[model samples]
Target: MPRNVTTAVAGVVITVCAVAAGAGAAVPGKLGTRDGYEDAGGPVWYWPVWFPIFAVALAATGVFLATRPAVHRPAAAVAAVLAAQIAGRAVVGVRDWFNADGAGVVDMSQHELATVVTVAAGIALAGTVAACFAVALLWREPARGWAALRPRSLRLLVAGAVVAVGVPGVIALAGSDAIMLAGTVALTAALPWGGGLAAAAWLGPRARKVTVRTVLACAATTVLTFPVTMLYLMVSHGYDVTSLFS
Candidate 1:
């Protein structure tokens, strides 16, 4: 397949899977809720239908992980990290579900739940970074002539950052609390592609936009924001890094 074709296809697959996975997480929470509370006290993150989402997410993340890691190695690495993060979340959610009581309430307090999930996120982030690094160390050096930063490229990047930051900010400033939270969740899940969309807005030549560099840039910038988003969520919940455990 053409490199362009694979990159485009992979991006679309990741995007569709992202939306589907989110629905999987959310729909189950709504399945048997009472005023938004579920078996786990507050619609625990994982439920029976979560797999369908995970399966689709797995497919999206698998694209760059498969036979062409060398073609878009940065994207492959990002995909790996995304997969690990999702897996970690699923693990904690399922663990909590199994550990819940007869009343379907998890034994841990809300603070404890936050702390554990935060810890899990940290582990997932660190572990994936290490693994990607190891793989890069073993892989052959990439070919020379990486695209140079040009005037237009710099502008595109700046604009992209503005868009990436602006989307969530706009949602927060404009929406009600419930809407803001939902928008944030949906945006965060899009990750690198959200960044890519920023790039696409500027580089909209249907034939020429989806290059390796753009994809990697978008993936790198967007995924880096994940940590920031997590931090924001913690603060929004009125918990500090220390407070979660305190």
Candidate 2:
């Protein structure tokens, strides 16, 4: 099969799966519930159908890991890490579900929260994939190019990812909780791309190796953010008042 055709198929699959997962997360017939609530409990983070949404996200993540880079070498390790992250997320997600009694009433506003998290996850995932494609599609020498990123560059990228994803969120929450949700979506989408660029800069190479180390690293970067964001949601108030649009 032609590489472009293969990549196109993979991209389409990623999009469809992501959309399905995200759509699964949305609660139906709840338009009026979109408003922000102060003192909303953490249970809102784990909606009733949370598993399906996460399952779709996991499936899409796997599909991408499988199809990315289009190299001859096996991607077993990358696949493994992707699986691990999803498994970890599932464990945490289920734990949250159980802790909330699984039958507990979902906050009317949870649909809003789910929307925020799902969008953010999608963005981070998509951006990292785009970065991988940028390396794979443009530079045949991904190994050499990715492997050459300096420490300073990697540090800068890490910092940039934090700021780009964080500052907007902080500002958004301060203005309106509704905008805080939007901030989550924006952060989830952009930060991993920045991280992927850094991964491409350092782990990325200009040539083939036993593995596309940079792509794997970039995927890991994307997946790792889930837990980090969850922790943030856990610690910080669910509502942000400083968001601009709120």
Candidate 3:
């Protein structure tokens, strides 16, 4: 099979896995309880929201890879966005850790905490891998890519920043916790990826070529792994499948 075709196939597989994982994680537990399954500190709908977004991004990346000869720009942009999302998630995790109140601590056992920590570490590692891939991909032709992307990257970054901050702020002002939570989660997950892609778009436009195909494959794997892992954790902790719309 052609390399791009292979990449596209892989992307499809990853998207399917991500969607499955999200569906699995969305399974609800006993009434008024999550069966000790914490949402990484978010609302019940978090996984339902998270997985679909991830799948869409993965699918888009795959399509771009399959159709485009030199997908360096778009791929790098996607990588950047993923990196930013990872960073944002990390920040939120740390902030939540510090801000956790006494009741929160009481609710989570040592094992649960350990599980959360392990999942977080896994996510962090995946993010790091994705970021590295993005950097390497961009550096393959730093001067050329950078030159082509520099002006556009700046504009994209600025626009992404504004949307990232502004949309959530507006949602918060609306005063619905559910809407605010959903908006915050969506933006936090999406904006960073946008910004990162834009920022990295202009980098390494004239660097030496590396095993881009392999790098892209690995990156896709890493991206898909996260949701799978999360699904496993949720199921292991006794979460049951529930309707996403309900």
RMSD of each: 12.7, 12.7, 10.4
lDDT of each: 0.43, 0.41, 0.44
Cand. 3 Cα-lDDT: 0.44
Model 3 over residues 1-246: C-alpha lDDT tens digits? 464554454444433433333343344322122245543443222232343455455445534544562555456445435444554454454334323422443234345444444444444444445545454444434455545545534654565465556556665776676564645454444355334434432444322112223234434555666677567545544466364337
The better candidate by TM-score, 1 or 2, is 1
Model 1: per-residue Cα lDDT at residue 232: 54
Off by over 4 Å in 1: 1-43, 47-66, 73-119, 126-147, 151-159, 174-191, 197-246
TM-score of 3: 0.45
Across 1-246, the per-residue lDDT of candidate 1 in tens digits comes to 565555545554454444444544543221133233243333323332223343354455445434454445454444443443354444444344434422444343444445445543443343334324323422333343343222235555665566556655666776577464534333433333344444333332431154324445434644665576566545433346887577
Ranking by TM-score: 3, 1, 2
Return the TM-score for each candidate structure: 0.37, 0.32, 0.45
**RMSD after Cα superposition, model 2:** 12.7
Q: Could you tell me the TM-score of candidate 2?
A: 0.32
